[model samples]
Target: MFAGKRILLIIGGGIAAYKALDLIRRLTERGAAVTPVLTRAGAEFVTPLSVAALAGEKVFTELFDLTAEAEMGHIELSRSADLVVVAPATADLMAKMATGQADDLASTLLMATDKRVLIAPAMNVRMWQHPACRRNAATLAADGILQVGPNEGGMACGEYGPGRLAEPLEIVDAIAAALGNGPLRGRRIVVTSGPTHEPIDPVRYIANRSSGAQGAAIGAALAALGAEVIFVTGPAEVPPPAGVEVVAVDTAAEMRAAVHEALPADAAIFAAAVADWRMKTARAEKIKKTPDGLPDLALEENPDILAEVAAGPDRPGLVVGFAAETENVVENATAKRARKGCDWILANDVSPATGIMGGRDNAVTLITDEGAEAWERMGKDAVARRLAERVARALGPVGAA
Candidate 1:
C-alpha cells in the first residue's frame, strides 16, 4: 500500500530497539523506502551497520558532521520524508519531544520536521505511569502526533504491564493508516463508543453492559480504510484503537459535548449506549440507607446525541446510528432511523439471551431508507469491516468528492 512512501525511522534506546530492525524490513517489503536514524542511546542496543544494511540507506547519527551539515542535511532530512517514525520511543525521548528539546540529532530532527510523526513508546510501567510522563504524552498527543502501541506484556526488566513495543506488523498497519493512501483517504469520520455513566451521587451511578468491542472494531476498520477518525468514547472496557484521535469522556453530557466538538466530518457513527436519564439533583454525598424509608430519586432525560447531530446544521454527509433493541429489532430500528433522521441504523438484539452486549460477536440488521437487511451472526471485527465497506460505497469515491 505504501508503494512510493518515504519513511524516516528513528530508532530510540530500549530493549525494544531490536524490533525496529523487523519494522524496517516490514516497511520495505511494502515498498516503502526506509531512512534510519539512530540515537546515542539507541546505538547501545543496535549497531548502525545492521540498520543501514536493512534500510539500504546511510544511517544518520550525528548533528555536527562536517560533510552532511555543510549541505544543511538536518533540514533536508527532516522535511524530505512522507512520515517520521520513532520506534521504541523511550521516556527520555518522549519527554524531549514533548518539551521541544532539540539537544541531539533525533530530537533536533523531530523539532525541525514538517511532516507527521508517529511514535511507538516502549518504557517501564512505572515510568510510563509517572505523572510527568503522562503529562508529556498528553502534550504530544495534543500536538497532533500519531501513536501505535505500548502493549502490555512481560518487560525486559522482569516486570509486566503496558510497556512492550507494538509488533512490527502492527506498526506497519499504523504507518499505512497515518499515510492514509487508501479508499477513504480524504474522508473524516466521528465514532462514539461505550456506555455513558449517569451519576447519582459521589459514589453511585447508572451504567450499562456495553464493552465497546464493536465500536472499537468499527473505528479500527474505518481507520484501516484510511479515514481520519475521531473516536469519542466513554469509560469503555476495551482501549481505543491506534491511529485515531481519542476523546475520553464519562457521562452522557460529556460524550454529547465531545461529539459536537468533533463534528463537520464526512460521516458520524453513533455506537455509544448513552444513558437515557440522570439524577435531576444528584446528592453531593453518598445516599445512605435510612431506617425510616427509602430515598426518592428524581430523573431527567439526557441529551440525545445521535438525533441532535443528525438534525444539526453542521450534520455530516452520512449519519449512522445503532439501536440495541430487546424485541422487534428490525421494526424498531427502522423507526429509529426515521426518528433520529440518520441515513442508516445498525440494529441488534441485546436481550439477555442474545449475549450481544459485552460480547465479541454480533448479529445486526442494517436498516436504511431503502429497507432492512439482516446480516448473519459474525465476529464484531467482521461486522465492522462490512459496515465500513458500506459506508465507503455510500460516501462514493474520493475522486468524486
Candidate 2:
C-alpha cells in the first residue's frame, strides 16, 4: 500500500515532533516518497538536518530562500503532493488554518494548497477543551479537513484527557487510506451505531447498554478498504475511528434525521439499536416523585431508520441492517431484511444469555437474500474486518468501482 505516492508532511512544533520522524520512516518503508516541511516553530522541536537526513532530501522551511523557490516555488510546492498531513498540529497553527491567516511560510503554503489535508492534533487538555478550539475544529471538519488523534489519556502537562497525537502507525494508516484510490475510492457509505436515549423528563431518560463499538469498527474497516464513510452514532462507549466523517447524536429523532441526510450512498449499514418507542409527552420540567402514585405516560413509535433507507429511491447497491434479538435471531432477522427492503442483515442473539451484548466479542449470523451463515464468536474487530471484506467482495473488490 502507498507505493509511489507523494506525501507532503508538515511537522508542527510540539513534544510529539519526534513521532513525525518515525512517521516519515513508516511512509518511506511503504514506498511513499515524502516531502518534509518544517514550520518556524517546528524547527524548534526537531532540526532540519535530522529530518533531511532521514527523508533523503532537503527539508523545506523558509518561504524567501532564493534557490529553493526557483526550483520549487511555494506555489508549486503547496499543490504538488497527493496528500498533505500535519502531525502534532498545535493550537496556533490550527487557529491559523481556521481563520485563513497565512502570515508565515507554513501557513501560507497550507492556505495556498488545494490538496486534501489531514491533521493529528496535539495540545494541552484545557486548550483542546476551550470553546475557541471547539469552534475551530468544527469549522475544519465542515470544510472537509480530516483529523486523527489527540486521543484521551495522560498528557504532557501532567494533566489527563484527550490531547495526545495519534500513534505513528495510525497516522501512516490514515495516509495510506487517503492515497489508496481503491474500488470504493470515491464511493460514500452511511453507518448508524449505538442505542438512543428517549427522555422521560428533565432529570431522567430511558437508554440501553449498547457501546456502539461494532458500528464504529465497521465504519473504520470500510474506510480502510477505500470508502468515504459517514458514521452517525448515538452516545457510544468507544471512540469513533479516525479519518472518516462522524456525526454524534443522543436521541432516536436525531439519528433518524441524520440518516436521511446522509443517504444516497453506495452502501449503508444500520447497526444502531435505535429506541423503538419514545415518551408521548415528556415533561418540560423534572417531575418530582410524590407520595401519590406516579402518572402513567403514553408512548409513541420512533422512526425506523433501516426501513426508511432501505425503501428509499436513494437505496444503496447494498443495504445492510443489524438485528440484535433476544430470541429467534435468524428467523426474525431474515424477515426483517425482506420487510426493510435491504440486501443483507447481520443478526445476533443479544439476550441476557449470550454475554455478547455490551461485550467485546460477538457471535453473528449473516442473513442474506439467499440464505443465512452462522459465524463463531469473535472480537468485534475481527467481525468488522470479515464483514467489510464481504461487502467489498459482494460489490466486487477494492478496485472494482
Candidate 3:
C-alpha cells in the first residue's frame, strides 16, 4: 500500500530507539522509500551505520554539511518527502516540536517540513504524564500534527504505564492511515472485547463463554479500513489483532475504566460479555469444606459499561452493544437497545445446540431504532467486515462537516 511513498523518518534518543531499526524494515518491506534522520541522542542508542544500512539511505545527522547542503540542502530534503515521521519521539524532541525549537538538524527538519508529520512518543512514564508533556501533546494535536501511540506497558526503566512506543506494525498501520490509504483513515473507534472475569477469590473467578473472536475480528476490520482502534479487552481465548492499541484488563471495573480512558472516540462497540456481579467481599483465604454446610458469599453488581457509556456525557457518535440471548433474540435485543440507550445492538443466540457461544460461525440480528435486520450465519470475520462497512456508511465521510 505504501509503494512509491517517501517517508522521512526521524529517530529520536531513547531506549526504544532500537525499535526504529525494525520499523524501518517493516516500512521498506512494504515498498516505502525511507530516509533516515538520526538525532545526537539517537546516535547513542543505535549507530547511524546500522540505521542507514536498514533504511538503505544516507543517514542525515548534521545541520551544516557544506557538500550535502550545497546539493539537496536541508530545505529541499525536508520538503521532498511525502510524509515526516518521528519514531521513539523522545520527550525532548516532542517539546522541541511543540515549541518550534530548531537548534539542531532533527528539529530543523521538523520545523522545515511542509508535509504532515506523525509522531510515536516514547518516554519515561512520569515524563509522559507530566503536565508539560501533556500540554505539549495537546499543542501538537491542535497544530494538525498526527500521533500514533505511547501505548501503555512495562518500560526499560522497570516501570509500567503509557510511555512505551507502539509496535512496528502498529506504527506502519498508523502511517498508512495518516497517508489517507483507507476509508476510516481519520476516525478513532473504541472496541471492548472478551468476557470479564469477576473474582470470587484470587484463584477462582466467574466468566461467560465469550471467546473474544468477534471483538478481535471487529478491531482488525476497523484498523484495515484505516480507523484508529483502541481495543479494551479482558482475558480471552483469542489474542488482540495487530495495529490496534490494546488495553488488557481482568475485571469489569478495570474494563470500565479502560473504556472511559479510551473515550471521546468517533464510535464505540461493546462486544464483551461482562459478569453482572462480583463477590462483595472476597475471602482472603480459600474456603474449605467443613462440618459447617457451605460458605456464605455476598455479591454486588458490576458497573454496566455499555449503559454508562451510552448515557454518559462523553458518549461517542455511534454506540454499538452486543446481546447474547438464548431466546427471543430479536425481541430481547431490540429491548436491550432501547434500555441501554445504545444506537445499535447485535443479538445472537448462544444456545448450547447452536454452538455460537464459542463457535466459529454466528447468526445475528442487528437491532436499530429503524427495526431488526437478521443476518445469516457466517464466520466471525465476515460479520465484522459487514459491521465495519455499515459503520463507515453510517458515519458518512471522514472529517465531514
Candidate 4:
C-alpha cells in the first residue's frame, strides 16, 4: 500500500526515540521512501547516522543548513512528502506543535507542512495524564492530526500506564491506512462499538463483557479503505482508532442517538453489545443494602438499535448487525438477520469456553441472504479487515463483483 510513498519522519527526543529507527526500517522495507528529520533532543538518544542508515537517506537536522536550504527551502522540504509522521512525539514537542511554535527544524516542517500528519506520542505517565497535555492532544486531534498510541505498559521511568509508544508495526499499519487508496474512498460509514453501560443507580450500571476490540478494529479497517468513519463507541477497553470521528457514550440509548445523528451514511455496522435491558427507574442515589436482602429491581427493554436503524426511514444502503450467541451461533444469527431486517449479520460464539467475549481473537460466521460463510478463527483486526473488504465489494460499482 505504501509503494512509491514519501514519508517525512520526524523523530522527537524521548526514551522512545530508539523505536523510531525500527520504524524507519519498517517504512523503507514496505516500499516507502523515508526522509528522516532528527530533533536536537532526538539526537541525544539515537545518532543521525543510525536513522539515516535505516532509512537509507541523509538525515535532515537543521533549519538553517546553508547548502540544503539553498537547494530546498523549508517550505519545499515540508511540502515534499505525502505524509508527515512524528514518532516518539514527546510532550514538549506536542506542546510546541499544538501552540504552532517553529523554534526548530522539526517543528518548522510540521508547521509548514500541508500534508496529513500522524503522531505516536511517548511520555511519562504523569505527563501524558496531565491536563495541559490532554488539552494539547485534544487540540491536535481536533486539527485532524492522526495519532496511534501511548499504549499502557511499564515506562523507562519505571512507572506504568499509557505512556509507551505504539509498537513499530502498529505505527506502520497506521501509516498504511493514512496513505491507502482503497475501494471505499470518499464513502461515509457509521460503526457502533463496545458494551454500553445502563445505569441502575447513581453509581452502579449494567454492562457486557465486550472489550470493543472488534468494533475498534472494524472502524480502523474502514478508515484504511479511505472511508470517513463515525465511530459511536461505549466504554471500550481498547482505544478508538486513528483518523475517524469518535462519539463516546455510556448507555444503549445514547449509542442509538449517536448512530442516528451520524447517519445518511453509505453503510452502518452495529457491532456494539448493547445491554438488552435497563433499570425501569434508576435511583438518584446508590441503593443501600438492607436487612430485607436484595431489593426487587424492575427491568425494561432497551431500544433495539440495530432493528430500529435497519428499518429506519433514512437507512443506509447496507446495514450489518452482530449476533453474539452462546449456542447455535449460525442458526441464531441467520434468524437475527431476517428478524432485524438487516442486510447481513455477523454471528459469533461468545460462550466462556470460546474465550472470545473479551479475547484478542474472534471466530465469526457471516450470515446473509445467500447463506452463511464461516470464517476461521483470527485476530479481531483480521476479521475487521475482511469485513471491510466485503463491505467494499458489496457497495462498490455495479461491476465490482
Candidate 5:
C-alpha cells in the first residue's frame, strides 16, 4: 500500500530504539524508501550502521555535517519526505519537540518538516505519567502531530505502565493509514465500541462479552481509507485504533453523551454492546451479603443510543447499528433497523456455540433498506474493510468542502 512512498525515520534514544531497525525493514518491504536519521543519544542504543544497513541508505547523524549540508540542507531534507516518523521518541526528545527546540539534527528536522509527523513514545512508566510529560504530549497532540502507541506493559526500567513502543507491525499499519488516499478521504466518521458498564454498586457492574475487536477494526479500516474517525470506546479489551480521536467512557449514559458530542460527522457507527438496564437506585457502597434474601434491585432501561441518535436533529448522513443475536438474527436485525431508523444494520449470530463473541472472525448480514446481504465468514478486519467501502460508496464522492 506504500509503494513509491518516502519516509523520514528518526530514531530516538531509548531501549525501544532497537525496534526501529525492524520498523525500517517493515517499511522497506512494503515498497517505501526509508531515509534514516539517528540521534546522538539514539546511537547508544542502536548503532547508526545497523539503521543504515537495514534502511539501505546512509544514516544522517550530524547537524553540522559539511557534506550533508552541502548536498541537502536541513530545510530541504525535512520537506523532501512524504512523512516523518520518530520511533522510540524519548521523554527528552518529546519535550524538545514540544518546546520547538532545534539544537540537534533530529529535532531540527522535526521542527522544519512540512510533512506529517508521527511519533511512538518510549519512556519509563513514571516519566510517561509525569505532569510535565503529559502536558508536553497534550501540546504536541494539539499541534496536530500523530502518535501511535506507548502501549501499557512492563518497561525496561523494571516499572510497568504505558511507555513501551508500539510493535513494528503496528507502526507499519499506522504508516500505511497515514499515507493512504482512499475513497473516504476528507470525511469524518464516528464509531462507538466495547461493552458499556452499568454500575449496580460501587464495586460491581453489568457488561457484555464484547471485546471491542470488531469496532476497533472498523475504526482502523475507516482511518486507513483516509477518514477522520472519532472513536468513542468503553472499557475495551482491545486498544483503540491509531490515527483517530478517542473518547473513553465507562457507562451507557457516558457513551450516549460522548456519541452526541461527536456530531456533525459524515457517518456514525454504533457498534457498542450497551447494557439494557441499570439499577434505578444504586447503593453508594458495595451491596453486602445480609441475612435477608436477595436484594430487590429496581432496574430501569438505559438510554437507547442508536434510536436517539437516529432520531436526533443533527443526525449524520449515514448511521449504522449492530445487532448481535443468538437466534432469528436476520429477522430481529431487520426489525431493529426499522425500529432504530438507522441507514444500515449489521446482524451477526454471536451465540456461544458459534464462538463469535470475543472471537476474531465474524459472519455478518448487512441489512439495508434495499435488502439483506449475507457475507461469508471472514476476519473482523476484512468485514470492517468491506463495510467501510460500502459506507464510502453510499456517501458518494467528496463534495465541495
Candidate 6:
C-alpha cells in the first residue's frame, strides 16, 4: 500500500521508543522510504545507527547542521516527505506541540511542518489524563493533526491505564489510512465500543469491566481499511481513534440512541458490552447507608441495541454483534446470533479466569450461519486485522464491498 511513499518519522523519547524501530522496518519493507529525526530524549532510548540502518537514510537530530542544511533547509526537510509521523510521542512533546512550544528540534519541526502530522502518544496514564495533557491533545485533534493511539494497558510506570503507544502493525495501518489505502476505503462503517454505564445515583453508577479496547481496535482497523468510520462509544478507558468521527455515550439507552442515529453504514459491528440491566428507579442523590440495612435496588432490562439494529429498517447489509460470554461461550454465542438476528457473532470467554475481558489479548470464536471459526490466543491487532478482512469481504467492497 505504501509503495514508493516518503514517510518522515519523528522519534520521541518514551519507553516505547523501541517499538518505533519496528515501525520503521515495517514501513521501509513495504517500499516506503523513511527519514528519521530523533529527539534528544529519543536518542537516550535508541541509537542513531539503528534508526538510520532501518530507515535506510541518515538520522537527523540537530537543529542546525551546516552541511545538511546547505542542501535541504529545515523547511525543505519538513516538506520533502509526504507525511510526518511522531512515534512514542511523549507527554512532554505532546504538551509542547499542543501549546506551540518550539524549544527543541522536534517541537520546532512540528510547528514548521505543513504536511499532515500523525502522533502516537506513549506516556504514563496519569500524565495522559492530566488536565493539561488532555487539553493539549484535544487542541491538537481539533486542529486536524492526525493521531493513532495511546492504548490502555500496563505502562512503564508499573501502573495501568490508557497511555501506551499502539503496536507496530497498528501504527502502520494508521499510516495506510492516512495514505488512503484503508481496506474499507470510501465505505461507511459503524462500530459500538465499551461498556455502558448505568447510573444508580449522582455519585454512583453500575458499569462493567470493559475498557473498550476491542471495539476501539476494530474502529482503527476499519479506518486503516479506508472505511469512513463512525465510532459510537460508551465511557471507555482508551482514547478514541484519530481519523474518524466519534460520538460518546454513557448509559445503554444513550448508546442505543446513538446507534440508531448513526445508521445506514456499510457494516455495523456491535462490539460494545452494553450493560443488560439498569436501575428501574435511580435515586437523584447517593443512597444513604442506613443503620438498619442498605436500600433495596430495583432492576429493569435495558434496551437491546444489537437486536434493534438487526431489526431496524435501515439495517446495514451485515450486522455483527459480540457475545461476550463466561459460560457456554460458543453455544451461547450461536444462540445469541440466532436470537439477535445479526449476520455475525463474535464470542469470547470472560470468566475472570480467562483473563480476556478488559485484557490486551483475546481468544474469540466467530459464529456465523455456516459454523463457528475459533482462533488461538493472539494480540488484539491480529484479531482486528482478521476481523476487518471478513467485514470487507462480507460487505462486498467498502462502497460497493
lDDT of candidate 6 over 143-252, digit per residue (tens): 89778877767777799867889888878877887887766677888999998999998988888789888888888778866788899999998777667799999999
lDDT of 2 at 183: 47
Off by over 4 Å in 2: 1-4, 69-72, 154-160, 180-184, 194-205, 209-225, 233-267, 271-273, 280-292, 300-401
Task: List candidate 5 stretches off by more than 4 Å.
Answer: 1-66, 69-76, 85-114, 118-182
lDDT of 2 by residue, 180-282 (tens): 7544566788999888989999878878779888887788777766788999999888667655788999999999889889887888998888888899999
Give lDDT per model, in order. 0.89, 0.83, 0.88, 0.89, 0.88, 0.86
Candidate 1: where are CA atoms >4 Å away? 154-160, 201-204, 209-225, 235-250, 253-273, 280-289, 298-401
- Taking all chains together, each candidate's TM-score versus the true structure is 0.69, 0.69, 0.59, 0.75, 0.67, 0.84
Q: In candidate 3, which residue pairs get closer than 3 Å at backbone N, Cα or C atoms, i.e. clash?
A: none
lDDT, candidate 2, equals 0.83
| Ranking of candidates on lDDT, top first | 1, 4, 3, 5, 6, 2
**lDDT, candidate 5, at 72:** 65
- The residue pairs in collision within model 1 are none
Best by TM-score: 6
Per-prediction tally of clashes: 0, 1, 0, 0, 0, 13
Candidate 6 error regions (>4 Å): 14-19, 67-72, 123-135, 151-165, 199-209, 278-300, 378-382, 399-401
* Candidate with better TM-score, 5 vs 6: 6
Whole-model lDDT, candidate 5?
0.88
Worst 10 residues of 2 by lDDT: 176-185
Worst 10 residues of 5 by lDDT: 173-182
Error of 6 at 224 (Å): 3.8
Residue pairs with clashing backbones, model 4: none
